[model samples]
Target: MKKVKHLFLLFALLFSSLLAPVGALTDNSTGASSATSTSQSSVAAIKKRGKIVIGTAADYPPYEFSVKENGVSKRVGIDIDLGKQLAKDLGVKAEFKVMNFDSLLVALETHKVDVVIAAMSPTPERAKSVDFSQVYYGDNQDIVINKADQAKYKTLKDFDGRVIGAQNGSEQYDLAKQQMKGAKLKRLDRVNNLIIALQSHKVDGVVMDSTRAKAFVANNDQLKAINPHFKTSGQQGTAVAVAKDSPGLVAATNQTIAKFKKNNTFDRVYIPRAGKYMSQRARQNTVWNYFVLGVGNTLLITIFAVFFGFLLGLLFALLRWSKNLLFHSIAVAYIEFIRGTPMMVQVMFVYFGIGELIQDIPAVVAGIIAISINSGAYVAEIIRSGVQAVNHGQTEAARSLGMSKQETMRYIIMPQALRNIWPALGNEFITLLKDSSIVSVIGVAELMYQTQLIQSATYKGALPLFIAMVIYFILTFTLTRLLNYGKRKLNRS
Candidate 1:
């Protein structure tokens, strides 16, 4: 009887210990529940990570834009300062990630960035995908037009039959669609591009925040701002966007913004600072100064992508040529899938999609990997065609001479295949060199991205574009000459 009682006591003690934690967790008196919840919060995660990534499109001046200080490009504006403040409040470092504005929400959703501070409005549609903090800044809308046409477009009705421009996926874009019923809307990915369209007469006027319009007019004598007096349902102020379900992060951001409101930090300090950066001399903006950085990165991406692409292509070609059914099917499926999808989507997938798993992957590395995978699919077909074009009797002759299949391919078939595929391979290289521009969407700092930077700095869009065109032509033309020289040498051999 005593042994039975002792066993019961031991089991009871074990059960109570397990239940003790559950009771403590359920009991609010001990505060253990609150402590656990706080530890699991998004704010806690950010604090643990030591840095908060801020996503921004650095093309809108007075809001967010790039500036060169001592030959180093820096992002500075109202939004950037606000981002820094938010990070400080969170007790973490601020790391800015520059990408297209249209990509911001996607980046937030994919965890590529922790917050978006690019002067983004907290619209209902966007709120469905991500939570937003309280609005930090608000202003009325205005239309920027040629100074010569200022007298012609006084009201919104004047632009009814005219073409109007706005940044794609922006509040101004929706407002243009809603208010300018009779106007043709030109949606661009960047505010700089919209300004360029306005300057080139492609867009008669651009709808943007009054602050930005005023800044543009102040910088360019040829441009002027006019209020079109578009109706608004409510104040369309910009806010910080965080991923959905991140209530703790949203609360933290709102707290930081409340402090900014109390201190008037944005109005008193950030604007004037941005203006000072913008006032730098235009003479310092020569396109030649940035050519080396631009060209070097472009060539680097092209060369690495080409080298890896060729190797992958040869492997896939062999797999497809293999008599094994499984190998051939995999090769066919890979080739078709990659060839069917757009290169831009692939680039984004590698950066944002694959990047979700492999945190801290460099944008340039992601761009190279995506481009190589894409190029490999096309290169595989080229290699397979070249191999096929070689006379089969040569393979038979080698084998009949006691050469193994591997030796036959390496010695007898590959030499002839190389001679035939040289021109096609050269063409592929040039194509890749040009297509590398697509990686600029993910902020690779290639030639096209550098040209955009120059455009933003000088505020002379057409000239920068023309300069980039000449540079691209020189690169491609020089490459063609070298290819021809190589072809001639191969023929002589």
Candidate 2:
């Protein structure tokens, strides 16, 4: 269903703010190492360890949602049950780690989690990362349109120019983008949020897994999927996965699936869980529009935020180091305030507060402005610290050589400061990548926007969201590595 999306510009901006990177290294290394010590060690390791840790983004539904009915402790849904059963089959207790939806794969790759049973699919691209058991569920993307607009929206071609949404870094997202060549694709990270966007009129339509669409639309009388025969594109077959080298977990998982299928338990679980949302066709793929417009919005916002943030940081740095006590005080106040207060609130103030001074301005403009201001305050403190780290005698020496104050600052103080600032600035760039997920509020359809779209589409809790997280980690991890590399380069220079 269609939503204006621009109104949510503020909401998206606020929502996309973020989690710090996987913060610490737990001592699972020995366990992970033992699992990898030999090809035959997986089952043995789990037996000796007495537990298998599963990682999932817990907010997903049906498949992996959290429930606390009847005043009991929280328990996961189908996925958790399935994991527990499989662990029992393997003679171990199943432990799950609830985390960001987008961070799962790297966690798996790094051996932070034992097996990824969070409704994982067998995408050709994803196969490179790990091995999978038999098809747990056949997944299909469903195309949804405003119930109000369904009459005029005869077919997929009619969707051209309409704003569509999906979760970023998701197979559905890529599929939506590829299929809807002419329409505008709004990509986000949280699948549930995308449904919210649809309800809010942020998108004209959205394409997602049939299961999630049923859950969300059944709740919202305003939306409806196109006819049962609606064309679909992305056909991602889902299954449970183990780390690439874990043949034991792989074999154990396959054996479980074999037992499940032989006894009809697979159908009993998969059908009621995911099949209830099946579209018209007996078996078909998910096809939806993509984000043809927002890619530019994403790049532009990042570039502008960096440019403007850098300039403002320089100004604040000058203020921070000013000889005048008043300016210095103002600078300190600015630094402490921005640092102390949350960036999301600051974004709200800029985009929703004084933003009224310029109504109907581009959403991207508001986004860049918000991030630039937020980043400037942070970079200011970084630059101030950098400049202070330089030797005081550098300035004195230049002045003693008869250079003017401005020239001395330019030739002597600034270079060292620049060097010092690079690392912090580099870190900001990576932060900027994660933070840009915030810009979605201004309707800048980026990665997180796409993720939300997928979440809304996939009724399965946490799995879709977790899938989005894995994609985000892939994105941010590369970003961190690049930033770290640059920091190294700057330090060397």
- Each model's lDDT comes to 0.83, 0.64
**RMSDs, each prediction?**
12.4, 17.3
Residue-wise C-alpha lDDT for candidate 2, range 200-304, written one tens digit per residue? 778887776665566546656778876333344334556786777777778888888778778787557754653333221112222122222334455566777
lDDT of candidate 1 over 1-493, digit per residue (tens): 5423432333233223323554553464235523432343388888999988899999998899987777777898899998998899999999999998999998777677888999888888888778889988888899999999988999988987899999988989999999999999999888988888888899999999888887788778899999889888644778998887778998999998898889888788887887777776344555676666788889988887888789879989999999999889878987887899999998897777665445556677778777888898899999999989999999999999999999999988988898999999999989999999999999888999888888877767788889888888999999899989999998998
Write down the TM-score for model 2: 0.50
lDDT of 2 at 201: 79
Return the clash pairs for model 1, or none: none
Best by lDDT: 1
> What TM-score does prediction 1 earn?
0.89
Range of the 10 consecutive residues with the lowest summed lDDT in candidate 2: 279-288
Model 2: runs farther than 4 Å from truth? 1-41, 70-75, 217-221, 227-236, 266-493
Q: What TM-score, over all chains together, does every model reach?
A: 0.89, 0.50
